[model samples]
Target: MGHQYGKKGEELVFWNSQKQAVVSNWIDVEDHKFEPPALELISELLTKPRNGLAPDLAVVAKAEAQLAKVLDVYEARLAEFKYLAADNYTIADVLHLPNLQALMETPAKKLIESRARVSAWCSEILARPAWAKVVEMKLKAHA
Candidate 1:
C-alpha cells in the first residue's frame, strides 16, 4: 500500500482494491486517476498562493478567473444532476466536500452560492452526517 505524510502533515494512502491515492490535502482518493475539473481545480488551488498572501490583485484575479471556469462547468452539470457523477453521490462529489466547505467561508463563496444548483448541491453534501462528523473532529482538534 502506498502511504505517506502529505505536505500539511495529513496522512495519505492508497486504499481500496484499485489502490486509489489521496490527492493533495483534500479527503479525496481515486484509482490512480482523477476526473476533470476536480483534477484541474486541485492543481489550480495547490499551485497558487494562499488567499491572503497573494502578491497583488492581478494574481488573485487570475486565480479567480481560472476557478470561475471550473465552477462554471460544475454549475452546469449540477443543474442537470444531483451530483457530479449523476443522481447518486460518488467519489466525484466526495472529492469536492473538503474544498467546498472551505470555499464556503471565503470571499469566493459567492462564486458557488450565486449558482442555484451548485449552492443546493453544496448544502446537501455539507449536511451529510459524515461531513458533519469530520467538521466536529476538526474543530475539536483545533480547540
Candidate 2:
C-alpha cells in the first residue's frame, strides 16, 4: 500500500513527501486539517528512543505528558466522531497504529486505555485484519 505519482512528461514521483501524501491519495479525503495532529503524534510520541537501550526517564515522562494532552483532544473529538481525524477511518488513524502499539508496550499505555473513547478507537483500529497480518509477518520475521 504505497503510492506512485508523476507528471505526464516527467519521471514517477515516489516517496516524494511524507505519510500524508500516501494517506491522502489512498483515502481520497481532504485531510489538510488533520495533518497537524498526526505530525504532533509522530513528533511527540513516536520520536522517543527505542534503540534497545533504556531511555532517559525524563524523556519518557515528557513524551507521555505530551501524549496525554494530545489524547485529551482526541477523547473530545472521539466523543463526536469514530476515528481520530474523522468519523470514518482515515490515514490519520492508520498513521497512529504502529507507534501507538509501540507506546502500549510502555508505561504510557495507561494514557490511552484510561480514556474510554480513545481506548475503544485504539481497540478497533489495532484489531483490523490488516494490522493483524502485519503483526503476524513481524512475528515470523523475528522468529
Clashes of each: 0, 0
Stretches of candidate 2 exceeding 4 Å from the true structure: 1-52
The local lDDT score (0 to 100) that residue 118 gets in candidate 2 is 86
The list of candidate 1 runs beyond 4 A from truth reads 1-55
- List model 2 lDDT by residue over 1-143, tens digit each: 32332334222233446634643553332133333434344444545544434445665566566667777877897898887544556556766777666666655678889999989998999998878999899999999
Maximum-TM-score candidate: 2
Cα lDDT of all candidates, in order? 0.59, 0.63
Evaluated at residue 81, the lDDT of candidate 1 is 73
Worst 10 residues of 2 by lDDT: 4-13
Q: Kindly report which residue pairs in candidate 2 clash with one another.
A: none
In candidate 1, list every pair of residues with a backbone clash. none
Model 1 poorest ten-residue lDDT run? 22-31
True-structure Cα RMSD, model 1: 8.5
